[model samples]
Target: EAGVAQSPRYKIIEKRQSVAFWCNPISGHATLYWYQQILGQGPKLLIQFQNNGVVDDSQLPKDRFSAERLKGVDSTLKIQPAKLEDSAVYLCASSPRDSANYGYTFGSGTRLTVV
Candidate 1:
């Protein structure tokens, strides 16, 4: 199966700068997820979407982070005024609506470093 696609595999930004990452899910996937992975820790779900609507975003830092899945195919995640603590890998994943049976396909992720 084809994997999800993410751009700018690495990024380095000064503190308080802004950055954005883009993702293209596998064809036919209806569910999408964005995750943040800090060093030595498991990935944390930042946002989730089913089709074009948001399913959950409780973990997303609204004050500094935002995401959208327009048309339910492509997605983007952005962080503004980034902090050192936000330096982590931003991962994008996708799955079918009935994903529990098939599992999710993840992208290589964008590594952001806040100086």
Candidate 2:
């Protein structure tokens, strides 16, 4: 099975700088998700999208972070004025609309470092 694709496997930036990450989900997937995984901690759901519409974004820091799924195929996440606590691996995952049986497909993730 094909996997999700993420760009810039790693990144480094000074605090308060801006950065962006991209993701391409598996073909035919209707649900896409973005997560933040801090070192030694479990992944936290940042946002979720069903096709081109947002399904959830309660966890996203709207003041500093934003994301969009264009045409329901590709997605991008951006963070402006990043903070030290923002240093984490930004993971992209995808699944079918009713994917309760099949688990999610995850990308290698973009590791961000805010010093």
Candidate 3:
């Protein structure tokens, strides 16, 4: 089975600029997730989706970030007026269902550089 796919492997933007990242989950997967990883820290869960419905977004910075999983298959994450603190790797992952044992498959990630 194919893993998650993300585009533009890298992105460089000046502070306050907007940026978007795309992801396509594995076939038949019903759950999707987005995570932000700062250079020296572990990945933080930004948002999660179960068949296009939001499951969790407690850690997401709502004022500057947003995401959507349309039709339960593809998803996109966007940042408006991105801040220097937003420079990090945005990762996409998917799972057939919520199970810690099964785990999720992650994409290569979109590395954002906010200068």
Candidate 4:
């Protein structure tokens, strides 16, 4: 089975700098998600996309963060003027559907550090 793909395995930026992460979901998958994982905490869903539309983004900090799925296949997440508290692993995942029974395939994730 094909798995999710992510790029720029790691990044380092100073406070107030900007950064971006990319993701490519498994072929034929219909659901994609972006998560923020802080050390010692469970991953938090930052955004969810079903096809090319946004499904959920209530947790995303719109003021400085944004994401988009182009043609429902590839996606990108960006953070401008990043803060120290934003240092964490940004994970990308995909699933066939948003059901309790379906499992997601996750990428290795991009580790972002805001110094």
On lDDT, the stronger of 1 and 3 is 3
lDDT of 2: 0.95
Task: Give a tens-digit lDDT track for model 4, residues 5-111.
Answer: 99999999999999999999999898999999999999999999999899999999999999999899999999998999999999999999877489888999999
- For model 3, residues 1-115, the per-residue Cα lDDT tens digits are 7889998799999999999999999999999999999999999999999999999999999999999998999999999989999999999999988776789999999999999
Q: What value does the lDDT take at residue 39 in candidate 2?
A: 96
Provide the lowest-lDDT 10-residue window in model 1: 95-104
The full ranking of all candidates by lDDT, starting with the best, is 2, 4, 3, 1
Q: Which residue pairs in candidate 4 have backbone atoms (N, alpha carbon, C) closer than 3 angstroms, thus clashing?
A: none
Write down the TM-score for model 4.
0.97
Q: TM-score: which is higher, 2 or 3?
A: 3
TM-score of 3: 0.97
Candidate 1 lDDT tens digits, 1-115:
6789999999999999999999999999999999999999999999999998999999999999999999989999999989999999999999987456878899999999999
C-alpha TM-scores of all predictions: 0.96, 0.96, 0.97, 0.97
Clashes of 1: 0
